[model samples]
Each structure stands twice: as structure tokens, then as C-alpha cells.
Target: MEGTSFLKEPVGGKSVVGKIVDNITNAIINGELKPGDKIPTEGELSEAMGVGRNSVREAIKILEAYGVVHIKRAEGTFVSQEYDSKMLYPILYGIILQKDSTNQIVDLRKVIDVGILHLAVAKLAAQEMPAHRLSRIEEALERLKVEILSPEPQVKNVHDADVAFHMAIVDLTGNTMLQGICNYVDKITRRSRMMAMDQIISEGAVEKFLEMHQKLADLLKTCDSSQISQIVEEHYQYWANVKE
Candidate 1:
């Protein structure tokens, strides 16, 4: 940890604790602190960064919440071993707080989903995909079918199934980063999906929604890139229509 004194004094506007968090996060991102490395003690950080111990402690807590670091009771705080889905919370929270219109959010989701489908279809078309690999998508679609067609389909159940179906398609792309980004976007749009589902149920069009999802599943199996974009557009069109 030699020569690691890169944190600067707090600047204007931002709180000292927030600045401390930023500095520590920057250190991690800059490769100064690798995973599993213990961070400087609060006393050391406070003195070096010209911040109070309380600020250092608060910064550590923020980092922990973001999955950027982990605290070992009685031991020092260390960088997280694996930055997993927990890291998506901050980004998801940001999206949730944004003032984007419902239609705009739906449009963004549509674009991401369509792009993911294109990549997945391309991959399937270029290679002989294993049946096992595609099984999850089929399973998800089956769950969705069951949920939507149930005698009394609950909105929450339908929404979860719907997310699983689309997430299955994202998984087919075999791109971790894409999957993560899609997961965040998909999570934030759950409310919109619920709203759309409610509208469909009220309109007595749940059967139509079921048919569209079933068709999308069928189209995915074909790996026909030429037709996927159009079908994907139609699938999302339902949401746009509902929004309008």
C-alpha cells in the first residue's frame, strides 16, 4: 500500500463523506486497490485524506453497500472478492429516480431487448447450439404460458414470468455484461410491465398477451435473424400501445 496517498481534500458542494467514498472508489477503479486487498484503517485514511474518522467510516459503509468492499468483524475492510449483482443496485436506483416518462422507459427497454435478441439469434444461427443451453428459455416460456393462462393470474406472478422469459433470451447471448445491463433495465421496468399487465387484464386481452409471448418463443427457436427484429418489435409494440 506504499505511495497510495492519492485521495485529496474535500472540494465544494459535495459532502466530505461523499468525497471520501469517491476517492476510495476511484482507488479501486484505478487498480490501486485490488480485490481482497485490505483498505487503510479509518484512522489512516482520515489522516491521509484530511477527513475526520467519521467521514472515513461513513465512506466505508457506502462502499460496503455498493458491494465494493466487505468488512470482516474485528478485522479490516477489504475490497470485495466478486462484484456481483449487488453492484447493480446503485445503477438501478439511479434509473428509478430519473424523471423519464413511462413510454421513454419502455422504449429504452425495447431497444435493449431487441438488440439482445438479434445477438442471440445470430449466435444460434452461426453455431449449432446445444439443446441444454436453450432449455432455460423454453422453461421460462412454459412458466410464462402457465402464469398468463391461469384462471386467476396475479399481476406479480405474470410480471415475474415475463421478466424470466426476456431474461432467458438475454442469457442466450452469452455476454455477461449484456446480461447485467439488461437485468438492471429489466428490473427498473417491472413497474411499467405491471401497469401494462393490469391494462391488458382490464381490457380482457390477457389471451392476446399470451399469444404474443408464445409467438415470440416460437420465433426464438428458429434462430431466424431476418424475422426476429420484426417479431421483437411487435412484442414491444404492445407496451407502446398500452402507454399511449
Candidate 2:
């Protein structure tokens, strides 16, 4: 924290809290600060930046909420060292706020889902995967099938099962970055996704919906990467039709 004279730079343009957030984030981006580095105390930042303590406190709160920084009860704040899903909230909100983002969200999801499916298929074809991992993928598919075929399937149950089924395939890739990004897109579109599931079920298309997931699960064993896009397009058809 001693060499952070950059924090003392005069603020201009944005609101006081926004400037503080940007300065600290810029410091991190430029390698002036690093993960796990302790941020200067609120009093120290206020004095350096000529801002009120309240502004610094608000900035710190925002940073902590976004998973950019971690605050200990008495040990002060430090840059986050590990992945936190909260870090994706800003992008999620930005995507949500955009006009006509449903198709965009559907497109975004289709791209990742297709990529993940291709990667998983390639990985499965290339490796002698552990029995447990293979079982997990099958188990997820079975759970979805069960929920969809239930005597009186609950919309929430079917929706969660559907998400879990794709996530299981995503997990097969063993790529943390892919998993993170996939989960972020999944979260941003959850409300629309749930509504889509309700529509599918209400239309008595439960078998058709379950069949699509079954085909996706089957593709893991049979379909080559070259054949992923079409299946993914069919998979996301309902999602794409959902209104924003």
C-alpha cells in the first residue's frame, strides 16, 4: 500500500465513489496492486484522494459486493484471490438491462452450449474418463427425464433439472473458465428459462422437451464436434422464443 500514490491522483469526470472504484480497479489491472494485497484503510484512501470517508466506504462496499475485494471484520480489505460468482453480477445486470436481449441471450447461450458440448464430446472421445464422471452425466440426464415425465411435474423441478443436465455436460470438460462463463449466462437468463419450461410443460410437450435433452445426452457418446450446432439450435428453440 505504500507505493499507491496513484490513489492520491485528483479525481475528475465520474462521481466520487465511482472514481474511487475505478482507481482501485485500474491499480489492480495495471499490476500496481495484486490479488490478496491489502487495500489502504478508508481514512488513508480518503486523505489521499481528497474524498469523504463515506465515499471511500461506499466504494469499498461496492467492491466487496462485486467480489473484487474481501473485507475481514478487523483485518481490513484485500483483493479477492479466488473465483467468486458475484464477480459476474455486473455483466449479468448489463445484459439484463439491454433492450431486446432475449434473442441476444439465447444466441449467447447457444454459442457457449455448443462450444461446451463440442469440447465435452472431444474430451470424452479422447480420454478414458473415470466411471464416476461418466455416471454423473448420465445421472443428470436421468434426473431431468424423471422430472419431465412425473405424473404432475412441477415447473420449478423441471426447470432446475434442465439446467443441471446441461451443467453436468459442462462439468465434463474440466475447464473452470468454461464452467464459470456457462454458469454466468445460465444465471442471467434464468427467469426467461423458467418461463420457457412452464410453457413447454403447459403445452403438453413434455415428451418432446425431454427428448431434446435425451438427444443432447446421447450426443455426448455418438455425435462428433462437427454436428453440435444443429442439436444446440434445437435445444435452445424454446429459450429463443421466450419474450424478454
Candidate 3:
């Protein structure tokens, strides 16, 4: 905090409290403040930020609410230990508020799926995982197979199974942040995916899609990154080509 200096007065129509929040956030981002490191006291922040104490307090409150910081009763405020799922709410909310298109959602899902596949493959290859670690993925794939083979398969059932398959891969990545983001995207795009499933089922492509998912599941067990990449590409590309 030694190099950190007083913040400039609020400008450009930004609220005073908003300016304080930005200053504290910038300090954290710039490594002037680090996780678990207590921030300046309200009086010190108010003086350094050139804002009223109430303004500084309000800024801290906002940060705490966003899970950006935490307040200790007897101790001072500190940056959050690590950003958790709560931090994703604001960005997810913004995306929903902007009314992103279905195509955009599909694109986002494709990106997340690709990243998850890559990381999962790498982790599986590099680490010594338990034999049963990927049981969830196998179980999900089995459920998908059953759903697709059912005489009267519901589109909703297939979609849920499909999501479960990909989510299992995301969970394999061992990165909590990426898992949280993918979870958020998956939840929001559930309806859009159901629509896509309807189209795929209508086109008589449900079996083909299920085959691709099975291939992905098989390749994951091999821990062959190249094969996994090929299967993942084929899986996502098939959906990309599906007419919306």
C-alpha cells in the first residue's frame, strides 16, 4: 500500500462512492492489495480517496456484497480469499439483461466446451487420478445413451443428459472458476438448448448426436488429447451446423 496514492475526485458523472469502489478494485487488480490483505481503515480510505467516510463505507459494502471483499467484525476489511461463484452473478445478469441471442449462447457454449475438454485431457494425462474418478462422466454418458434409445425419448431428457455429460467434463478440469462460469452459462442456456434438441430430433439427427457424445466419452477415458480434440470438434461442429 506504500506506492498507492490518494484517488482523484469523482468525475465524468460517476458517483463519489463509485469512484472509491473503483480505486479499491484497481488496487486489488494491480496487486497493490492482495487476497487476505486487509484494506485501509474507513478513515484512512476516506482520507486517501478524497471522499467522505460514508462514501468509503458504502463502497466497501458494495464490494462485500459482490464477494469482492470481506469484512471482519473485530478486524478490518480484506479482499476475498478467492473469487467464487457469487462474483459471476453480476456478469451473468448483465448478459441476460442485454438479451444475448441464441446464436451467441451457442457460440459461448462451444467455447466453454472446447476449453473444458482441453483442460480435462491435460489434467487426466498429467495427474494420477483414481480409477473411479471419471465414473460420473461414464454415468452421465450411460444416461444419455438410455435417453436416446428410449422408444419415446423426450427432448428435455436428452438435453438434460447432454448437459450432464459436458458438465462432467467441466468438473474434471479441477478449476473452480471455469466450472462456475460454465455452470452459469449452462443454466441460462437450458431453454435455448431444449429448442436446439427439438430441431435435432425433428431432423432425425438425435442418434447421430448421441453417437458423437459416446465417442467423446470413449476418447476421454483414453486420455489422448489429440483424439479428444478431434471428437470435441466434431461434436460441437455438428451442433454448429444444425439449423436454428
For candidate 3, report its TM-score. 0.83
Question: Residue 115's C-alpha lDDT in candidate 2?
Answer: 82
Candidate with the larger TM-score of 2 and 3: 2
Angstrom error of the Cα, residue 131, model 2: value is 5.5
Between candidates 2 and 3, the lDDT winner: 2
lDDT (10s digit) by residue, model 2, range 1-244: 5789669777779899999999998999889889999988999999989999999999999999999999989999999998887887887788778889888878888888888888788778878444367677789888988988889988889888888888888888898877888888877778999999989988988888877877787777774677688888998888888875
Q: Give the TM-score of candidate 2.
A: 0.87
By TM-score, who's the top model here? 2
Query: Candidate 2, which segments miss by more than 4 Å at Cα?
Result: 1-5, 128-132
Q: lDDT for every model?
A: 0.78, 0.84, 0.77
Among all candidates shown, the one with the greatest lDDT: 2
**lDDT of candidate 1 vs native?**
0.78
lDDT of 3: 0.77
Q: Please, what is the TM-score per model?
A: 0.82, 0.87, 0.83
Q: Candidate 1, 39: how far from true, in Å?
A: 1.7
Q: What's model 2's overall lDDT?
A: 0.84
Runs of candidate 1 with Cα error greater than 4 angstroms are 9-11, 126-129, 150-153, 174-187, 204-207, 241-244
